[model samples]
Structures are given as structure tokens and as C-alpha cells.
Target: MKYSIRKLALAGVALTLVAAACGDDGGSSTKAGGTTTVATSTGSGTGSSTTVKNTASDTGVTETTIKVAIHGADLSGLVKAGAIKGVPEDASVGNSRRIQYYLDQWNAAGGINGRKFESVQITWDPADPKSYQTSCQKIIDAKVFMVLSAGGGFPPDSTPCITVDGKTQYMGIDAVSAKQFKDQLGNFIGLAPPGSASAKAGMEILAKDATLKTAKVAVLRSDWDFANEAFTEVDKVAKAAGINFVYSDAIKVANLPTADANKNVALTVEKVKASGATSVISMLNFTNFTVFPTEATKAGLTLKYNILEISSGMCTSFSAGQLPPEMNGASCVTHWNNFRLDNTGAKATDTPFEAQCRKDFEATYAAVDSVGKGYPAITKTNPGVPYPGFKDGTGTQLDMDQSYYECNIMNVVKAGITGAGGNLTKKTFQEAIYKVGLFDVAGIAGGKGSLSANKLWLASNVQQVAVTVNPDGFKAGKDANGLYQGKCLSPLACFRTVPNTVTPLTFTLS
Candidate 1:
């Protein structure tokens, strides 16, 4: 999950896997920097059914319809202005269409509890903070029961408008901190694991790795709240494992001018090199991650990179020539399944839900392309090819990401609604999520997920992977259309999940 942050030259923030928020235990627990109210119960759940009252008088719920809002950013203007390139003309429309495909399917099959979903699409400018507030106001004005933040765009600060003031149920695919989740009360549910959780899990995994365990490592992060929280968690984990960091610093000029931020990154690289660190664990977002490594290379510094999943879209950037060649072999600890591996025959296997998502996504895009909407179809030159993101070998990797997130998020909404039972309200939805526990999601760890009274985030496992360039093309070979069959684009890089490195994200609470 990568998104644009305020005043950053590039649009890249780490939007990791979605998970629920931390629950209140009526007692406070002290952490590295502060005290947090922790949940007494673990809040783990298995997907199970529980019956509640069938009568409904909830807000935004009528006898026959449940109004919801699909919130997204209209980035076509950015493309037109030449501020951003290589993106679709209208991403919001495509995203909404993809989500609507599922909603239409569900309604056709008879919606949950005799009520069909009626969704309204809300679009805003990503570069404008005022637009976020305005978009929240629009959703409030529409009086929708829930807002599905379909893709990355929403900021944490603007969330309280919808979840707190508007008193609406909100489920997003963006990353959120445990503190942010607690502030949202029970109205917010995120699709990715919290930053704190991912940091703890990623750091612990690196600590146990044979190569990194005793290596002098530098920890780098930005000044954003999520990034800061992640750094704190990493520090805690490193201390517990007795793994000391040779260098640790945060880039604090993110909100300053672009020149200042770049200068800061360069200075940090020099500091890391001076510290005699052999490896760096990057907790920065996608944009900063891009700059940091480039600066390191410029400073004649060589180091191994272990990146957190918060830098979600870095793999695609590396493949697309957006990142420096120095990042070719960086490693990541992530819960996200490598779509390139599954799409190509290199690792030819998909979880049941992943297969279904690919099928539906191809069908949806094929329809859109047939209408000459300019959106490329998921077409392969060969008939036997399973699912491809290119048409004539000229397409962006964002298509794959969009499809994955849309499918997973829609499924999450359905599962939550169905689990909530006949009588539906925000409270019932939250309770149902906790009660149902682990549910099925596509393209995540084994398609298993959960939200509980204690655990707010949903990721169950993480895997160690390294970015590798395929000197030889994909195993399937090139198609007649000149599209690389099994391999990615030239320089052919993709994240390969390491064998036997799949580990559950089990971290002890402080």
C-alpha cells in the first residue's frame, strides 16, 4: 500500500497490510516511549456465526438498502498536469467499477439479511488537505453507513472526521497506527496490520536471521507518526533480542522543502556509513526509501537493505526503473503474497481466494477495455497464460495492486456484513468482526485474517523475501505480442519469497 504524503516530491507512503485496532483492557501498559491501554483478552477468533436480533433501525439502513461510500482519490488531474505519470487517466472510476462489480454480484445473489448495498463514490484530490476534509463532509452529508477507503489516499488525521465526528463505520486498506485506531473508537477497521505490529514482527524476524543477527545494523525511519511508532517497536524488539543498532536516526525534514529533505537523507547516509553499519533496516515510506538508497550509493556507501512492508510498492518501482539499481536485491518482511511470482509460472500457485480474485479482476477489466475506456485489459498473448498485467507488454504494475486490494477489501466488507447478522449497526459490525475472528482474504498470508477484542490488525504471518532480477525471462517465455511471458520487464526484478521462511506474526505485548 503506497500513497502520497504531504509536500513530498514523490507520491509514496508505506500502506501496509490491513488489520483491526487494539482493544481496551481497562489497564495501561508501558512501552518504550509511552504508556498504552492494552487489552486483557487476546481477542483471537475463528470465523464463526453468531445470531443477533433480526430487527434493524440503524442509521443509513433502510428496510431494503444499506448505503455505503467508496472513497478514493481522483489523480487524473495529476497525470494531466504532468505532475505524475504512468497512471491511469481516471483511477477512481476504475477502482469504483471494480468494487461495484462485487457489490453487484452480491446484490444479484440476494444481499445480506434481505438488504442490498447502495454505494456512492466519493473522489478527492490527494495533494490537498482541504480536499480530505471536504470529502469527509461529503460522506457525512450523504449519510452513508460506512466508508470503504478502497485504496491508499486517506490520511490518519482526516479519519477522525468520518469515524469520530461523523460517527460512521470506516474500513480502509491503508496502514494505521495502534494509537490512531484507539482514537477512532470502534468505528475504524483497517485492512493492513498496524505499523507497530509490522515493525515488531519485521525486526524480530531480522534479529533471528543468521546473516543479520550479529551484523552491525542501522535503523532508519521518517518522522511520521506511523513511522515513529514502528521505530519504537523495532527498538523494543532489538533490545529484547539483544541486537544493538550501530546507527539510528529519523528523517525529520519530510514536511520541509524537497531540497532540505534530500539534504537530510544525504547526511543520514553519511552518518550510517560512518557508524560502520553493514546493514540497514529501513522503516521509511516508499518515497524516502527511494531517496535514501540513492543517496547512500552517491556517498559511496554499500550496505545490505532490510525493508519493512510499509515500503509496500518499492518492488514494483524497482522493476519499473523508478528506483536505483543499488536496490535490486533489498529484502522485505511482508504479509503480502508476491503476485508476480503467482502470475508468472515461477511460483505457480495461488490461495483459493487469490485465484478467484484474478478471475473476477480479469473479467471486470476485460469489460472495461471492450468499451474502449482506455483501461488496458489483463490480456496475455498466449491463450494458456493464466493472468497477465500487460497488453502487448506495455502496462503498469499498479493494475495488479489495484485488483488485489479491491478484491480483498470487498471480500472483507462482505465477510463483516454477513458475520454481523440480520440486525446491523456499527456496534454489531464491530462485535461481529471480533466474534468471527479469522476470515478469508485474497493475496495475504494463506488467505487467513482476524480482528478481535485485543488484536485490531489482521495479518497472521510474514515471509522473508529478497528482490531478484531474472537474467532469463519468465519461465513461460515471451508471447507473440512481445510481452515477456513468465518474466517481468527488462532488468526483470521481483520479490521472491524465501523457502521455509514463512513465520507467524507472534509478538508479546509490552
Candidate 2:
């Protein structure tokens, strides 16, 4: 289940694309007594105006620097303890390196308003819930103005320690509930679409699909706030579509120990089987893909799967042998476009920005490897090919997901700083980010990225894809670790985009 941590983090970042031209206030401004005051539009599409005062005394800001804390999960300890699986030993290192690379570049380019960014790197063990709060407290104690979480394992409960109590801006590249965002008082910014939007879109897709619409669906969700919010949206979509769910329940042991969580999932499988449901719509995280399918198979239950969130990792899990045979033909409604799929046409191709990001990452990794860091270097024969399934010399693939996420989030930070103008206060940063309208994002499909005061989420659209195993076997050779490398081969799979299923998210604040 701890594998869900990394998957959720990657899903949040990879699914989001935010870029836009900065809009103007068109009003006068003045500065006095260590305060900068400006008149700006409210950006609520209501033609309203307000005065915003940005003080130099704001926390974490000094004459020559703006302090930020970058938080990530150090899963190495858990992996070595045999408590977690399928996570790289250098996961935290990779994330920190990418973020630091961007910060260095920005600082070298004369950072926001001549104030260079000063970041404090922080890490926590995922197996320890107390560590999450400790990480948050560390950032608060550091007196950073902003907390930029690079990956998952930052529990929702710990977030308020920074955003609410500490009064700092929190930008997370992970999924969270719509309520969480609202409760933050405009302090929390998520890179991915909220769980409500993702769940609603999944149900909408099921309603529109000819075959899935008539199926008796069972809704399964975890007890997490984000999953519960998703379940609520699912219910709304089902009611509006005039579709009835055969069964619906939350896994009660979501926050419990592994044994209790497994027991809960097993019992849920029994209930789902008894409900006479032919399909299941999952509102949980990546754990659903790993645990639920295996449990269902054990009970001899055969159900069509439709996952609402973390679909990127879920789709690939089938190929990696992480999921049971019950998930062979599962479908996912997600913002991710699987570049490993064969028949995706232009969608599988990388944009110019994505290509450049890969080049930059490769160069960075090469530099690190030169210093005997033991990190995998980009060894792909073709520079144009996507790195989803490419195996490195260590038999592990370069984490393109993390790379893309780091790139996108850094771009968003830069945009926010640039849009904030000379007054780099939390208020100005939030307003600036909200006013940055649609722009091109590297990994996202064209015209699918936007942000506004009303629309805090970055992703604009979602697509459904089917996970299917490829018929052809592995390509010619093997990696240094004896793992086969190549295109979608036998045990390896592909997430083919379902035709005519691309849907835009309804940009409404719930």
C-alpha cells in the first residue's frame, strides 16, 4: 500500500499542466511604510476590484531572499525494512535534485524581484505518520514563506500545520480533496485536478459509454478525505445520469495497519460479489489497483474496473506484474496520456517542451553520474522516444513521471513569482497564480491547461484508456539486471486511449 504514495505523487504532477500569460491589474498602486498597495481586479469574472496590501514584513521574506521548504518522502528506509515495495532507493534524491536544478537556474537568472530563492530540503519516512507532522513543523520552524511538496506521504492532516497555523503558502504536487483546498483559506495549491473533479468525470464517462452505462456498478472508496470527496461526486453523477449503484462502501481500514487494510479489502470484495455488480468504479488511490483486484480474484469475482484517480501508475502496474489477472482489461478515466500505448496517434508524441525537459534531465543525470552518484543515465538509443518503459543499466527505468512533474511544478512556481510582480507576498503570489490564464504545458496535450480564481486546479481535461497486454514478446536483449527491455511486449502492457472519450473538466468550485 505504501507504493500508493509514490504513485499518487507521480499522478498528481504528471496529470497537471499549467502555463499562462500574466494578466494586468490596470489599476494604480503605491508603496509606503514597508507596505506595497495595489488595486487589482478580483478575477471572479464579476468586474469587481479590490485593494491588496503586500508588506515586506511577510514571513520568510527578506531584502535579498525568499525562503521555501521542499518536502519529499524518503522511502529508502521502508524499502530496506521490507515494509514497502517497487520504490527506488534514490526516489527522494531524484526529486530533490530536479527541484534544486530549477531553483539554481532561476536564481542564476536573477530570481523574482531580485530576491533569490533559498530552499531548505526536508524528507520524512512514509511508514511513520508522526514524521509527516514533524516535516511540516520543520518547515514552520525554518520560517519559510512557502512549502513545496515534491511527492506524496505528506498526510492531509499535517497540511494545516503549514497553511493554516503557520500561515504559509503550500503547493503540493499531489491529489487532495476539494474541501481541503477550501479549508486552507487560499493557501493550498494542488497541481492535479481535485478528487471531486476526477471522480465526477469518471462517472460521466461511464454514463456516456454505451456498454458501461447499463452495467451494474459497485462504487468502492477509501476512508481518506480525498477518496470520500470523490465518492460523493460519484453519487451525484450517478443520480444525475439516472444510474443506480448496486453497491457502495468505504474501506474502513484505510488508515489502519496493513493487516487490517487487507482484511477490509477482502470483506469489501465479498460484499461487492454479493451485490451482483458487474463493474466497479474505484475512488481510492493506487492501492486499489494492487490490492482490490487480487482480493477480487481470490473470491472468483470477475468485474470490469474503472479507476478514477492515479490511473497513470495503475495502467502501467498491469504490465509490471503488480496487478492480478482480474485487472487485465481495466479502464481508467484520467488526465494521463500513456505514451507506451501503440495506437494513440499524435497523443503519444512528445511536445517540444517535453523533449527539452528530457534533454535537460539527461544532462543533469549525466553530470551526477560523473560524480559516482550511481544514478541511472539516460541510455535510450532514440532521443525522440518516450521514457515510460525504457530500462536503464540498473534494470530500473528513469522516472519520467518525476522528471515531468518537477519540470511542470517549477514552471508554475516561476509563473507565480513572475506574475506576483515586485511585491512577493503570499497574497500577491496567490492572486498572481489565479490570474495566469491558459498556457502551454510540456507533457499535457495542447489546449488542456488553464488556471483562474474560480478554477484552482491545473488540468483541464480527462481521457479514458484500456489496459491490455501486448501479444508480441520482449525485444532482442536484456538489461544489466537481466530484465527484458523494449516496446509493449508480452508481459508488458499498453494503455490504449478509448476512442471519443476525451472530456473536459467542468471548471466549477464545489
Residues 1-510, model 1: lDDT tens digits: 112224221322111211112212122222211111213334574344433334333557654578889888776654575434445666777667677788788899877766788999998765444577678768877878788875554765567667776778888776667776776777777666777887788787888877877889998877767777878888998888877699887787444433455567667987898999988887765544557777887788888888887533433323233445676577778776644452223543556777778777667666545312465564422222222233333333323432466777777678667755554567667887888778777656555877776666566777776765454443444555433533443324456566666677764222
Instruction: Show the lowest summed lDDT stretch of 10 residues, model 1.
Output: 14-23
- Candidate lDDT (C-alpha), each: 0.63, 0.61
Error of 1 at 289 (Å): 1.7
What is candidate 1's TM-score against the reference? Answer: 0.76
- Across 404-460, the per-residue lDDT of candidate 2 in tens digits comes to 556666767788876675556666687877777665565442334777766666677
- TM-scores for every predicted model: 0.76, 0.78
Q: Which stretches of candidate 2 lie over 4 Å from their true place?
A: 1-57, 77-84, 257-260, 310-321, 338-347, 368-374, 379-402, 445-447, 470-491
Q: Over 4 Å off in model 1, which ranges?
A: 1-56, 76-85, 210-216, 242-246, 253-267, 270-277, 311-322, 340-346, 368-373, 380-388, 391-402, 470-492, 507-510
Q: Which predicted model would earn the best TM-score? A: 2
lDDT of candidate 2?
A: 0.61
